[model samples]
Target: MSGISIVGVGNMARALAARALAGGNAVEIIGRDRVKAEELAGTLDGVTVGTAGAAPAGDIVILAAPYAGAAEVVREYGDALRGRIIVDITNPVAPDLQGLVVPDDSSGAQEIAGLAPEGAHVVKAFNTVFSHVLAAGPAEGRPLDVFVAGDDAQAKARVSAFVAGMGLRPWDIGGLAMARALENVALVELGLMNHSVKHTDFSLGITLLH
Candidate 1:
């Protein structure tokens, strides 16, 4: 089983932690508030908790925070996160939920990658899936699609493995530059959910007709 550490104790954190536990991965919750981290960890089996700034003990670390918070966490960790695959799962959507907050030239994942430690590879994934859908398992009787992008091939592969282990599909959409498109698509999905779709339980995936 993979060793995974998640930063933040919000809905996304809880959802991801639950999946990680179910996948038999060793999970750790590290939050800014130690009390909340401990509380969340206590609710999960074989999981641990720690405060922020401490060295991460897992090979894979998921940043289950908002776009701004994700950047701050990466900056704060600095070299302490070296040699770890840091998964940036934040969508930089506008507060009004109408569009993306990031410029067309960049993305939340790319910006977070800029602040990551030298050897800490930032792979974008899970931004397109909602927390509730993740908790409920596969979407529309199909496994969730996790779109991943990163500069490092090995890093992306590791993240893909983790996603597949959790019973989801990991689609490698190319290098880190593609993250901008991923975030933009997520914004579009939000728009659909708010207007036409009118639901948060759907996930986007390609249907192969072989």
Candidate 2:
């Protein structure tokens, strides 16, 4: 499995690191707060904390932050991130955090794609899954489905492998434009979360009725 570079030190970033390491990938985390980054790294063995400006160059960089944070990190690391697979986990929800903040035809992933290097490929995944749900992979290690939307076929393939390493199956939803639907799906999922009685996360899975 290819190693992963995570660009934040929050819950989502930690979750990605845990899942990636558990999936047999080398993980490096970078962010603004060195102390917090180091703390999170200590929680997970085999994970290391590196400088934000000097984060490891990897096959994939998971932007595990909000859309605002994503933009900031991409802008700062625009040059270093060239030719790498960038996974945009940002969902631009309103202040209420219940609905999307983007207008029709544009999305968080699309916005991040704009700031990226010409050849840098960006995709959307893991936005819909609750952090806790992903923290614990499905029992028996069956792959959960991660719907991916991106423009570059090669980048998508790399991300697909990374997703699989985390014990999840990656489903291609077509070009980067497809991320709009993916984000909306997350909003719908959030609505469902509010009604849940407990911390048990409800995940979406496609099943054939036949």
Candidate 3:
């Protein structure tokens, strides 16, 4: 089991914390609002709470904040995150929801990596899966597929192990550069939800034939 510190008290953070605890990993919830963080931690058994800007107790730190605030969170953590694995789960979608906020040449994860402290390994995961779907477990009887992208192979492997522990499949789709594709995939998912599916119960996955 791995030590997981999530730097947010939002839905995604709560969902990830619940799954992490279920997988026997240590979970810590940190947020700018101490009361909110404690409240979220109270809902999850065995989970701990911490304040923002504190030294995260876990080696793997997940930035579960929205795309607009993820960079600020990284900057706030600064040198404290050095040598640790930082997970970027933001999609960088525009407020209008019609396009991406990030430049076409770069992704939200890559931008966060640029702001992160030296020695910190930033991996992009969980952006494709919705918070509700993630909290509710597998969709349509198949384990959810988590697309992982990172420059560090070991970091990706560690994250994959964590995902597998939670009964999910981890797809290592090349290096951190692939995070652009993952974000685009999430954009497409959002588009489908708004226009085609008209609901949020479904998630993106790969079906294999043997």
Q: Among these predicted structures, which one has the highest lDDT?
A: 3
* TM-score sort, best first: 3, 1, 2
Residue 120 alpha-carbon offset, candidate 1, angstroms:
1.2
- In candidate 2, list every pair of residues with a backbone clash: none
Residues 1-210 of candidate 1 have per-residue lDDT tens digits of 889999999999999999999988999999998999988888888889866998888999999999888889998989989999999999888889877787778888888888887888989999888899888888557778889999999999989999999988889999999988888888888888988999986878878899
lDDT, candidate 3, 28-110, per-residue tens: 99999999999999999999987788889999999999987889988888999998999999999888887788888999999
Q: Which residues of candidate 1, in runs, are more than 4 Å off? A: none
Q: Give the TM-score of each candidate.
A: 0.96, 0.92, 0.97
Best prediction by TM-score: 3
Clashes of each: 0, 0, 0
Residue-level lDDT for 178 in candidate 1 = 92
Cα deviation of 110, candidate 2, in Å: 0.5
- In model 2, which regions exceed 4 Å deviation? 139-142, 195-200
